[model samples]
Target: MYQADIAIVGAGMVGLALARSLKEADLSVILIDTTPIAKPLSEQPELRVSAFNAANKQVLEQLGVWQHLDQQRLSAYTQMQVWDQDSFGRIQFSSEEMGTSELGHIIENQSLVNALHHQVSQQPNVQMLPSTRIAKVLAGQSETMLMLDSDEVVSCRLLVGADGANSAIRKYANFPLTFKDYGHTAIVATIKTAAPHGKVARQVFTPTGPLALLPLSDPNLCSIVWSQNSQQADELLALSNSDFAKALQVAIEGDVGEIGVESARMHFPLTMRYARQWLSDGLVIIGDAAHTIHPLAGQGANLGLQDAFALADSLQKLAAEQAAFHQARQLRAFERARKSEAVKMIAAMESFKQLFGGSHPLKKLIRGVGMCTADAIPVIKQRFITQAMGW
Candidate 1:
């Protein structure tokens, strides 16, 4: 059997980031995934993208992976506008207020993954096994043996589950998960606008749900996440491209002008998942394997990146102190800290969703007053800026 200090399952963004972060720990790492990672780079923007805050960007920088990302594909927005539909509640902010160049960047998921996979591949201490998955996980006191489909067996001192929402590692380890069905289906697609986005990220809260128009590198292009209840989503998805564009034009109230579908529409149900236990005997989970939050605030990926960063830092310190990888106390502490952050984010999303979910007059009035108040007050605005920028 092949022997290593650590084995990480799932070579997606989060998994690759974790492997890259551990490059300097002088520990042998084997990264495994069923899918081939870091596929050929694409010049065209992808349908799935993520907004990265400063803190997460810093994490990538520290891992020496940020410099590898393509500059042309990165879209930086200096402004943001959020408002309630058909109400006097509208709020807008700019980078100038915070004395920053940008609030954040929107990058295609594949773009970032390619960059990270490139960096991780260079680390001599890391071995990446793509197109191979763990067929069986044999547990033991000192180590665990991973049986692969190719009949290759590997032993590791610690096992990490970074595999996404339906993580096989998480399931095999018997980690309990607490989840909530948001009853929202999100339609995502690439869109072209008649009006230039002007480097602004905009979101509108409608009676049915929320719609976010995320600016892309091209001034006239954007990636949209239009979330609505199941019934509404079904109707919207059934409409023809032309009809849907008309419907989108009305829903957006012409904020970005005419809407043209530039890519195929794809969607998935929204759900919040939190693993009741992130640490198991001889195993631990991170990223989506640990928890998943609502995308309304765009904190899901940022949160997962943070988890990998923190765990890496913890592992480095532990190694410096000559501590065992499976020491109960140290592992537990790491788990607690990351879990707390996830809980806070989950609570914030639920509260925000409920607060703007309905058309109740009283709630609308409260939202209008609150948003306007936050916009008008520098202190309150600063608080929001701090959160959005991940300061």
Candidate 2:
């Protein structure tokens, strides 16, 4: 049987980041994932992407993984504009107004994953097993054993499931989950705009859903995330490239002048999920396994990175105390910290969705009044900036 201080299931962003953070602390870590990580240098640009909040970027920088990324391919958004279709009112937020340099950055998902994997490989205490599956997980009060598909077994003091929303590891633990299906689907892609993005991220709310244009490295390029009803999403995806672009134009109401298709569109159903328990015995769930929120705020990945940070901090504290690697107290602390943040984020997203998604006259009045109220309250604006930056 292989042995390590910790065993992580899933080598995606959250798992890799967690391994990198803990490996340098004199702890043995084994990261297992079914999909072999690909080399980022060989992939074409404008593929799957994610918005990295400021706090998450700091975490990557501290892990020394961010430095390995191609800076030229990133886009920093210094400003944002959010508006609704029912009214001609819009709210604009700028970094300058908040006394900051940037709100966040947009980067390709593969780039971030590749950089994290590269860093993990260099850590002496980290062993990465790619294209491997875990057949069984056995958790005890002080340790866990992971049975692999090949009949190989690995033992660790603690087990972490960085696996995504449909996490098998989480299921094994029987963590109760609260699930809400919005009956909406998000269509994502990249596009070329006739007008420059000007370092701004724009989100327009329509009756169907929210449409967002996030700035990319290229001035004329923008990342599109259009959330609509199931039927609307199906119709949009069924259209040809030209027709889809036309529909996108109408959705954003020509925010960036003429828009052209630059990447193939992909759609995914929307969901808001929260696991009642992130830890049981010697196992814990992080990232999407613990909580999955809507993409409206672009905080899903950022929150997952924060989970890694909190877990690493807890582990370091336990190590300093000379406690066992899988101390229940330490794991519990990690879960509490992460769950508190997740609860707040989940509530915020749900509130936003309900307030703007309704067609009632009172809701419209509240929407208009809320924008004005936000503009008038400088403190509220600053608070928003701080939250957006994950401060």
Candidate 3:
């Protein structure tokens, strides 16, 4: 039997970050996933990216994972602009108001995963099992056992599910989940604007949905997440790259100037997922396995990172106390805290979605008044910036 003190079922950014954060806990960690541990960094920028706030970045810096990242690939956005295409609702925020150098950094998702993988692999207490699958799991009152497809068994006191929104571990553990379709499909791709992005992130809400133009390392390059109803998304997806670019240019009303689709467009349906129980006897779930929210505000990844950090803290304390037998019960506080945060985030996203979704006259008026009110009040804008910064 192969065993470790803790076994993480997914080797993505969240799982690897958990393992890396436990380096000082003096406990063994084994990470498993069907995919390779470190995905190859492509010559061109990857289409998948995340807007990491200052809090998560500070934690990464503390873990030494930030240093492993290529500085050139990181885009520190100092400003943001949000407006509703159907109305005159517009709000702008700047890092200068918060006395910070950056509001956030838009990093390619794969790049951060590779950085975490690099950092975690070097820790003597951590082990990696890549290209492997768990054929079965048995969670007892005191321990969890993962049976691998290779006919190997892993016995650990605790098992963590970081697989993703459709987590197999969560399924195996029978963790109850609540999910809802957002009725939106997100189209993502790398894009080039006619003019420089000026290190600013911009989002525009249309009658269909919202479009986000996140600045990339290059001034002319950006990554876009365009969410719309499935029907409209399909219509747009059917268009050729050039035509799609033209459609995009018209969507944001040429906010970024002439848009050019620089990469193949890929899309996925948007859904919200929340696991009612984050932990059970000998088993637990975190990250996307626990909760997922809309991409409108770009807080999903940050929430996952927060989960990892919070759980790491709890587990470290448990290790220091030399807890055993009833260790699962000790994690209730951790689960409760993270779950509460997830609920709050989900509610916030839902409010934003409903408030800005359509062309209702009342909603449009509210959005316009709200944005103008926020922009005019320096204190209100500062509070918004602080909240977004996770400060």
Give the alpha-carbon lDDT of every model. 0.90, 0.85, 0.91
lDDT of 2 by residue, 241-317 (tens): 99998888887888888889887788899999999988866788899999999888888889998898889888877
Residue-level lDDT tens digits of model 3 in 319-374 = 89887522658999998899999999999999999998889899899999999999
Ten contiguous residues minimizing lDDT sum, candidate 1 = 322-331
Question: TM-score for every candidate vs. truth?
Answer: 0.98, 0.96, 0.98
Superposition TM-score, candidate 3 onto the true structure:
0.98
Runs of candidate 2 with Cα error greater than 4 angstroms are 41-46
Query: Which pairs clash inside model 2?
Result: none
Q: What's the true lDDT of residue 339 in model 3?
A: 90
Which ranges in model 1 have alpha carbons more than 4 Å from their true place? none
